[model samples]
Target: MGTSWSLQAVAPPAGTGGGVQAALDRVVAQMSQWQAVSDLSRFNRAPPGEWHGIPAEFAEVVAAGIDIGTASGGAFSLAMGELSEAWGFGAAGPVDTLPDFMVPSDGGIDLDRDARRIRRSKGALLDLSGIAKGYGVDLAADWLLANGVRHFLIEVGGELRGEGIRPDGHPWWVDVEVPPSWAGAGWRIALHDLSIATSGDYRRGLAVDGQHYSHSFDPRTGRPIANGVRSVTVVHRRCMMADGWATALTVLGADAAIALADEKELAACVLANGREYVSRAWREMLG
Candidate 1:
């Protein structure tokens, strides 16, 4: 419920161009293939014990997630599958919970790069909720570009990235959704060669036993982040960075998130408690 995306490429409008239609079909098929979260979800399941091989894409994404998690101080780990599932946030978990926070600290995952294997030492699940969608968006954009489409805007599951300028010579526009009650406040970003992602607890909330739980979980604590922030949006040159930052900031809450964005010079907008705090870099990018 966070965000969904669409792609508008300057090839001929759907029915008007046969070649464009075929290319679009190819891109759609690719998106579908990579978005599945089942066993096919490369980030969901750990490698079998004694199994040392993985698909190239799986290896790549895992490596990327590990890097991001480390960089974010373990704020964006892939080892959240078990906790998410236990709380019914997984393909098998319940969506009902009154408590928003869960205890942190769980088993560890041992990743072997040379052997191309991952071992969940004590059996924790891996969930790539923060970055997978952005990865998919980037993949779609790459597919379109490689297929000879120079100008396009791709949005998938609320994350977006733009390639080239539109025929109008303006950068693509993507709106950052603020809580509806926040009057007259919106953040719209212009992008030509960047990807933007927004994460929020406004939706996908679970209510149980007089408590409400957010969908965003903290890998360190193995529970939902109690950050009262409504939304966090990040814009970056890499779709993966934008995606992960949006998630990391959402988990970090508004104040700390803004400070971190400032320290890192990441373009960001944080909405919380009926107000918005925008990073200087993000404000500059808008102009």
Candidate 2:
């Protein structure tokens, strides 16, 4: 939520631009951890075991997060708020002593869909930074479509979702950044009503005592990932899924990540230790 958002839409109504911006703003207002009064912040501070009512959008994102977390076998977790804060990624800033290792409580979050309520058990901290941006992009795309725009590309903080063809009849194309530590040109992919999200360790990491700590925290180790994988990019029908999967796969490193991507038939590309690994689905997509 602390990042840039852009949208390119065709034939949008006169006032539709403001609507799209407002849609993204609403998502950030509801889910941003930087804001003290945000819905997610309040829910994080809410007493455990109490059902805290949340907006429908927030509830939906939480449900998706839980689903992905379970599917990744806890590789993707929303309950790393404390770890993030300890590592100076959160509002609390850096601390002299690192917090003790703590495994995320996978099933601690309970959501009541009918009531639009969420309750956390075992003091699990909730952090939605990983997936909220992608959801915001999806919402922006929906906003454009609902406003009579048939073709659009929406990107929030690098995660993107595109639908329909460009006005010139060309598919929406995006460049996958080549890691700074890697060689060769970045790949260009055509987006045909699909979404792509990439997670990388080269950016947004901290170094302490000559050791690099990535922004991605592995829930299993309660620490930032120090794996050989440099980046993971995933393409999916929904940006939210792609966003979450990219983070999960990055945490799993190159081999396990590609394995899971194949098992799920996901289109993913992994860059690790100066080499590139492409899944079968991704190869087909490239072709």
Candidate 3:
């Protein structure tokens, strides 16, 4: 997680701010791909076909990643670590040529929940950059609540989760930013015990040979998605789900993304081809 994070909670007993910062730091240390000694990095470097034990938090995130990937039909995959690095999005920076690697099948990586162990069958690279920040937000929220702060809002990067009302007795409000490429009044939503995450091409991308490559990659093509969809936002009770869904929908583009959002009954907004599409569930939430 190479992004800024903020936590706003009902004033906790004095001197508790350090505890929140420590908890967030732990999440970064455990999951950041940029950190050489992170749990995820060690797991990625581990020899294939060998069962490696991981921390409970790492296991939980990986489990959630696999579940979301399956549900999104591979639109969201943790196995794109190599692809990300090849495209210069990872710590390795950009390479002159894309790495030669076979895309991992859905079941290429196996996780044993009971044993907290994982093994990869085909040397698949694991990258959790897309969802790790959201998980961090959730972890921070839980820390605040457990430490006697019930009203709080947690945001890492652009992913956010909020619950309860502020000390002023108002629900947490967030303004969804409009993509720079689009023209419109920004949308605002009152978040109460719900989380929202947004994905956009304008945020992080690489330009090569006079063409732009987004960080969001389509697993099917093993390349950056060039879909006309510029952004996707999803709201869910859990920030992690919203984060993953936003990225998945962005890769799926507008039509398919909206269709899947409806199929899953998710509250989502997709900005594509100079148009905005809101899922039925999102409209219901707005109302």
The alpha-carbon RMSD values of the candidates against the true structure, listed in the order shown, are 4.2, 1.8, 2.0
Each prediction's TM-score versus the true structure: 0.82, 0.94, 0.94
> Per-residue alpha-carbon lDDT of model 3 for 1-287, expressed as tens digits?
77888877787777567777777788878888899998878878988788998888888888998888898898988887877887788988765544566353343668999999888766477788888888888888887888888888888888888889898999999999778959766678788999999999999887766777788888877878898988898999988889888999999989999999999999999988889899999999866
Ranking by TM-score: 2, 3, 1
Residue pairs with backbone overlap in model 2: none
**Candidate 1 per-residue C-alpha lDDT over 61-104 given as tens digits, one digit per residue, 9 for 90 to 100:** 56778876777777777767666665776666466544354665
Instruction: Give the deviation of candidate 1 from the true structure as CA RMSD.
Output: 4.2
Candidate 3 ranges beyond 4 A from true positions: 94-107
Evaluate residue 263 in candidate 3 and report its C-alpha lDDT on the 0 to 100 scale: 95
Output the lDDT of residue 150, model 1. 83
lDDT scores of the candidates, listed in order? 0.69, 0.85, 0.84
Question: Relative to the unseen true structure, what is the C-alpha lDDT of residue 87 in candidate 2, on a scale of 0 to 100?
Answer: 76
Candidate 2 residue runs with Cα over 4 Å from true position:
94-107
Which pairs clash (backbone N, Cα, C closer than 3 Å) in model 1? Answer: 3-157, 3-158, 4-158, 5-155, 81-125, 82-125, 88-93, 88-94, 103-221, 104-221
TM for candidate 2 is 0.94
